[model samples]
Target: MSVGLTQPIWMEMALALLILPGVWCTSWLVLYQDVCAVRGSSVVILCTYHYPETLVNKNLTVEKVMWSHGRKQFFDGPFIIDSNNRTHTATKFEYVGNKVHNCTLQIHQVEQSDSGEYAFRFETNNGGKWTGSNGAKVNISELIISMTTPKVHGPIKEGDCVNLTCMNNCSSAVMWFRNGKPLQEESSTLYLCDISFQDSGNYSCSPKHHNRPLSEVIRVSVEYSPRNTSVSVWPSSEVLEGSDVTLTCSSNANPTLNYTWFKIDGDSCLEMVSQAELQFNVTHTGNSGKYFCVVSNKHGRQNSTILSLKVKDHAEGMAAVTLTILLAVLAVVPMIVIVPMVTWHLVAHRKKTTAPKPDTEENTQTTEVHVTSPTSDCSLTEERREEEPSQQDEVPYATVHITKQRANIQQQNEEATAIYSSIWEQQAKEDLYSVVSRPTPRGKQAQDDPVIYSTVFRQ
Candidate 1:
């Protein structure tokens, strides 16, 4: 019975052997596959092994390794592992780790044409038959790169530091080419040169990797000239009669340049105006509006900022000024003539109202009673009982006054009349063109004399 049981185990082991062929065929197909590499780069090959002898296969050996170029052998070497577990004199195969059986093949500094299929074989035991397998077939490809665009150097002036930079897509080293020629050997982030007429050209660059091609070219044009040339008048927007006006043209160029004036119509080219001091003495309103100027030399050309002119009315402004002066004179004249005459008449009237009357017997008594203000009721009765004085008993008095000053008064009156008459004489003197009824000489005229009279009075 025990033999019967053991016999079934043997049959099952034979069935397992039949499935091993399919598994080994799949593993063999995957071992020798393709390899890929880039130019100016490194490459690595991965290889692993399997054994069916039921041992671990720890002490393995790889011999007669070769790399071929179309049946021509270029590389051949052996991989030897020392007893001390240290490496010595191994060509291309490197032992990575002990857990898995793998031989890694490495190639340094690969090129574009290093692509092809390689073939080799390996044997481990003394009586073991060699197993043949195809090595990797590699396909080489290029790396993509981009170039930076060029920029315009500013403020576009001469004798200034102008710098340029050419950058690559990758971080590798970059080289610059200008006008189809290589630049200097030193590696700098920026290329610098002082700007001048000779600095304009085409520029480009290329990267240091063998996978990339030359970059696209860029053209640079420089405009180095003056700017902000402007023209202005002294008093803007208005030009007065007989006024000295100025037109100034200012720019930023060098070497003491000259300016030329020009005038433009609606659709025509510029026509030259006066080359002198940029200013013109205009007499009428037609000489107003837009004007232009041009500045040029062997280097470049620039046009002046447009300047506009305007004129004002002269005759109307003068007439307004004259009318204002006449109004001021008329307002001030009346106050001069009336103030003194009103003052004299007020003084005479004040003197007449304050004078005292003459004295007499009855009038004196009555005056005495009224003059003493009544202190009590009895005194007030006495003041009323005092008979109102008869006109005869009242002051029948006369006042006679004489003075040489009166003669002075009469003479002043005569002088004032003479002054009024002389006013006519002054008018005649001034208006020599006045019409007259009778002809008269240019000298003095006839006049009258003074008189005295006496009078008597009774009451």
Candidate 2:
């Protein structure tokens, strides 16, 4: 059974040795011969004594019994127990005897200093005293576990044998333990064969007793090859293009080690970097594949399982989405401003060309207009009028009214009485002339900006 250092708790003993006396009488004192006990445990010495009923006038009444263990006197010492003066005795020792025969002594929480011979003494009512000279000897020893192994060439590796011995010359049967748990070993020599990492721990041993005491702890360390090799990837999710990724290799081993990385290319494996970690600045999908790692040391080597990788092309995907967004913007722009603006301009231009207003002269193309700057104005020519007075009186010119009104249509022969026709119809050519306006760079004007016309006719 497994045992731990507690407040002196109980245990399961495989065997028990009962020291019962079959017969006893006619002796003044009876004591145990010799015994062995462990530390932190209680020890009992089976003892008995006899005394006569009477000695002269004093009655042989055994009133007091005392015990001594490796001391000068059983009546006076630090390690003494008295039956009569139980209150004056120290708590470490107890005398469980009666007035008749039993003189058993009990020692609690035994230590190394408690190891020695134990003697018993008795006193009667009349001052009759007797002490047992042949005392029972008690051997005290502390238990511990010690280790021994063959000289290793380098280090104690797997499949090596280790021997663990219960120490301090402990003569009792002991149980071997590792890390507070009991093993199947019972003897003092514990054999560890084909030891591995599982065999490494703090080993101990304890004597087979109900109130057992554990030995001093001894650590056992075992070294072996790389085991449980594994690979870990940074950015554990989907990897993007133009990003950083790292893969790390790890294993359980003793001493120093070396790490090697690999990648599965198509159907074959390719050796990559030779370090504990490998970093890559991913550029394209070409960097996506299955990868693994191998760890090694002076003892042996091991390989890890494959880890899959895939790189996503983020740049190209963003470009395609950007083009789609620009196209959507272009499709909606014409409806918002361009189409409405062009429609407004075309409607304004068509109104200008189709119909002309009747009262406004600037919009009518049929009206003949005469415009002059402020510096050029026509004046009333009284001298020209005086020079052609006779011709002006003989030819009376018709008045022309300027208005923006459409005229009635007429045939050319019906309205042939123009000024040019009248001038060509003149029969007497006696230099007939009248004042006329000159169509040149110079002109005369009245204050009201008026025009005048004159003509000569033969009578």
Query: For each candidate, what TM-score against the reference?
Result: 0.25, 0.50
Among residues 3 or more apart in sequence or in different chains, the pairs in candidate 1 whose N, CA or C atoms overlap within 3 Å are none
The most accurate candidate by TM-score is 2
lDDT of 2 by residue, 1-459 (tens): 111111111131101111212211232445464667777667787776665464443456777777777636533444377665646748888777676878777888889998988877777675555666556788887876677787744466789889999965546578777888888778889988898888888888777653343688888888888988888899863577888999988899875689889999888989999999989888888999999998888889999878888887987658767999999999998789988899999999899877776753332222122221112113324665567565443433333332222342123213332222123224333333333332221232333222323332333
lDDT scores in order: 0.46, 0.65
Error of 2 at 224 (Å): 1.9
Those runs of model 2 whose alpha carbons end farther than 4 Å from true positions after fitting are 1-27, 39-42, 53-62, 83-100, 127-129, 142-145, 152-154, 167-172, 210-213, 232-235, 239-250, 255-291, 309-459
Candidate 1 lDDT, 1-459, residue by residue in tens: 000001123443345446555533442222444566554555665645443443132333433233334324322323232223343654433434232345345655556666675433333342222232344566665443232223433233354455555443233465656687776532424344555545556765555433332556665444455567888777765775555567777775543456787655567646655453466666776666677777765457788888777765587547656788888888778766677778878887888776765542221111111111112323224433354223113322222232234325446435532210111221112211111111121342433322212121221
TM-score of 2: 0.50
The 10-residue segment of model 2 with minimum total lDDT is 1-10
